[model samples]
Target: MPKAELGSTYWNNRYISGKTGWDLGEASPAIVAYFASQRNKDAKILIPGCGNAHEAEALIQLGFTNITLIDISEELVSTLQSRFAKNDSIHVELGDFFEFSGTFDVVIEQTFFCAIDPALRSKYVHKMHQLLNKGGKIVGLMFNREFPDGPPFGGTQKEYKTLFSGKFNTKMDECKRSISARLGSELWVQFDKI
Candidate 1:
């Protein structure tokens, strides 16, 4: 399918139809470990394409004060709005990641980068750079392999390095704490905006 076809309607339908095979139903262990090591509980953090927002919940538990979540699916965002209504620390918005505007100390990437069309990878990098404050970092997992064709599109570390080189400084390695299904296939990346 063309990249434009994978917009909000497509994603909302996926959520409505229960086709979200990518939903892990809980926070990712690697991300959780990274958050636990952080001393700053008040960092302004953004999680774009934040489906179900498991990481946001994990952040709340860790005492994070300013968490923002944006997703293309209105259905998912509605649910998130309701879910986080009582928590002032978390903000939920329905919008495209590329169009959303914000500056954050940290951006948590999970399956978001893979969910976009491969053609948009460069745009994704730029948007990430724009969303982060100076010295801000993007931290999380990216698939270290390929898919047939996907919302869970996969990529290699070499490609990722080249893609991000001009915009950020990166540290990537095999993720030791990935869930069993993704173990050895996930790369834990920390990209600091330059």
Candidate 2:
């Protein structure tokens, strides 16, 4: 159950108004480090809620050929399509994350977790389990603190661990490579689908 109607209209308005304070403007340093260590540059990677698709840009720069970027905002997706128009290695889609389907070797969880309604946390975990290959992992950062109100919702390591328990061999800890502004407040998560 959703507390508010946090749908495409809500997100579109956010983008249309430039209220995206959560857009790190670039890929998270922690995610970049994870990508740097991956030997499979051609591995299928998906970034849901891919505002600005910074990680895709970083992935392309690292020679990764298969990357997918999905977001619910038509306004943002239009911008993304233009940004990567010349790059066939990147494919961008405007749609809902839960209903969007694909198999991915690595699903970069950049802000997607905290951005959804808290009630959907379990659903998100289930969807991740379904989308991943057997050894697939969801990597990147999650805010390990609470917010007064959110779409940009926040929570602690314990809650996340419990939510992802059973389905994923989870690793949630404070992110050392997070940008200075989010440092100490974000958890560097690496959950391998079980």
Candidate 3:
């Protein structure tokens, strides 16, 4: 099969056509479960490429006050602005993740990394390093299996290690037992800024 086009236009069209298969419709179980056990309510959290931002809502319910969400799609961001209008705790922005600037204590990655062009993997890692404060962490799932075609590009543990090593320390990069269907072939990763 030929690879599908996957640029800003492609992703924007996906949002316009409501073809967002990546949206879980709720906070991811792995993410919710992980943060549920934490007691910090003041952590500076960021969720780039935060489509629909279900996790942001969940975080607000958990009493986390400082949350920021960024996405490149104007349509999605517009919808999100309205959806979160009454909620003052979240800061939503429409922008490229690479050019987004901020310091965060925790960055949540869901489907963001896989959605980017595979050639930008190094830039993604570097940007993550730059966006995080020292000792800050990024925790989320990553595709552990290779897709025959992608945007939703898949990767192996070795590939992730090579991509993040030297720049960050791996706290966890193991299979997530509670992932949704079709995502059984994924790994949960937690990278701490070195």
Candidate 4:
């Protein structure tokens, strides 16, 4: 597919057709554990490329008060807006993450990074830095292996470190608690904006 074709329309159609293989049906275990470990429940958090937003639900249940979710897919965002309409703590926006601006204490990364083309990796890192407050963190998983074809583009720790280390302090480890399908293949990353 052409790079341009991978924009909002491609993703919206995925949602429209229920082609979301990336939806884990619930919040990712590694992410949930990280959130559970946080002492502050009111930290400002952002979840970009937030399809289905299972993490938002987890955050709400954990007493988190400020959360933002963004997705390029109109269909997905519309559904999420309605799904979260009655909740005052969560804000859902339909837009591109690179263009969306907000300062967050924590940004949750699930399958979002891998969903983008690999060539945009540097842009993704820069945007994450822009979206964070000083000492803010990005906590979640990244695929540790490669895929033959990808919407699920994968990368190694070396690449991730090289991409994020200049702008952030980075730590990565095998995620033992990953959901079965991703077990052993997922790397839990903590990238702190310096």
Candidate 5:
């Protein structure tokens, strides 16, 4: 976990200073592939801590109809709301994700998990449970490695499995389709609220 609480102000400054190394500029291919396989175009999907939201863009491209994006950074969400203003299929809101509320059939986890303070991992698990409908699942990529210091606090599958154990039906596999640079370090994670 970070010595300082990784909060709205900290994240806002990251974007302002252009320190967003986590902004992939495009959707993670593995995640996009998963979206491509989803048959329901109208599934209610939420992307928390959504940065730049390339995955949301991909979801729109793939014909998804209801996508919600929430983030703590006002600067980023303002730009996002403006960016998607004309699109009814995507909704952008500026707020702390932990306090944000909505129920969804699917939650997309891109780099968001790694970006949170590790000490809040269990809180994250509880929040996700509350946000999802029964049988609804969270699917996307997570780091399978560790970072020296981070907003991108990394973790191994063992930790994740333990964290989610009683609350979800979890499945994780080494992500086979991660973009070249991230391929080896990523895991494809799916956790259905149990």
Candidate 6:
């Protein structure tokens, strides 16, 4: 149940207008730190709603060989496709994340979840479950505070616990020490599929 203002077109418009406040310009520091110690260099990774795909770029540099990035907006996809054109290890697609099917060892979430309609949070949880291989995890950040008006919709830890509990074994959910500008305002999460 997506809210009217948070539909694909709404997001598309955000991209079209260059109004993406969530774009971090660089890969998230927290994700970079997590991957720094990662032993698996060939794991299949998915980054749904990947805006500029800074994370995918970082993963490529880390020697990752399989990375898939998906987004519903063709506008953003075109730009990213061009950006990642020379990278054989990264695949970019324009499609709805919920309908995209694939198996991955790691699915990274950035500002995506909070940008969608709150009613669809369960769908997001279930979709992540469906896309991941057993023991695979979703690692990244989620907003810890609610917004006044949003495609940047927000929620608390309690809501996330109920949203993800049955489908995933929550491994970590706490404030991250390395978040940028929005310090102390984000939840660093790592939910492994059960």
Give lDDT tens digits, candidate 6, residues 1-194: 34776657877898999998888889998888788779898999999999889999898888889999999888889998898899889999999887999999999988999877778889999899999998899998888889978768878888888889988877555666545577878888989898
TM-score on alpha carbons, each prediction: 0.98, 0.96, 0.93, 0.98, 0.97, 0.94
Q: What is the alpha-carbon lDDT for the whole of candidate 5?
A: 0.91
RMSD of 4: 0.8
User: Across residues 9-80, which tens digit of lDDT does each residue of candidate 5 receive?
Assistant: 899999899999888889988888998988999999999999999999999999999999999999999999
RMSD of 3: 2.1
> Number of the top candidate by lDDT?
1
lDDT head-to-head 1 vs 5, winner:
1
lDDT of 4 by residue, 127-174 (tens): 999999998999999999988688787888989989998899999999
Off by over 4 Å in 6: none
lDDT of 3 by residue, 1-194 (tens): 22246556677899999998888888888888888887888889999999989999888888898899999888899999998888878999999899999999999988889888888899999999999998899998887788766768878888989899998888555556555584568788999898
The whole-model C-alpha lDDT of candidate 1 against the native structure comes to 0.93
Q: Which residue pairs in model 4 clash with each other?
A: none
- In model 1, what are the clashing residue pairs, if there are any? none
Q: Is candidate 4 or candidate 5 better by TM-score?
A: 4
Candidate closer to the true structure by lDDT (higher is better), 2 or 5 = 5
The best-first sequence of candidates by lDDT reads 1, 4, 5, 2, 6, 3
Q: Candidate 1 vs candidate 6: which has greater lDDT?
A: 1
Least accurate 10 contiguous residues by lDDT in model 4 = 1-10
Model 2: weakest 10-residue lDDT segment is: 1-10
lDDT for 150 in candidate 6 is 74
Count of backbone clashes for each model? 0, 0, 0, 0, 0, 0
Q: Candidate 3's C-alpha lDDT?
A: 0.86
lDDT of 2 by residue, 90-140 (tens): 999999999989899999988888888888889999999998988999988
Error of 6 at 137 (Å): 0.8
lDDT values, one for every candidate: 0.93, 0.89, 0.86, 0.92, 0.91, 0.86
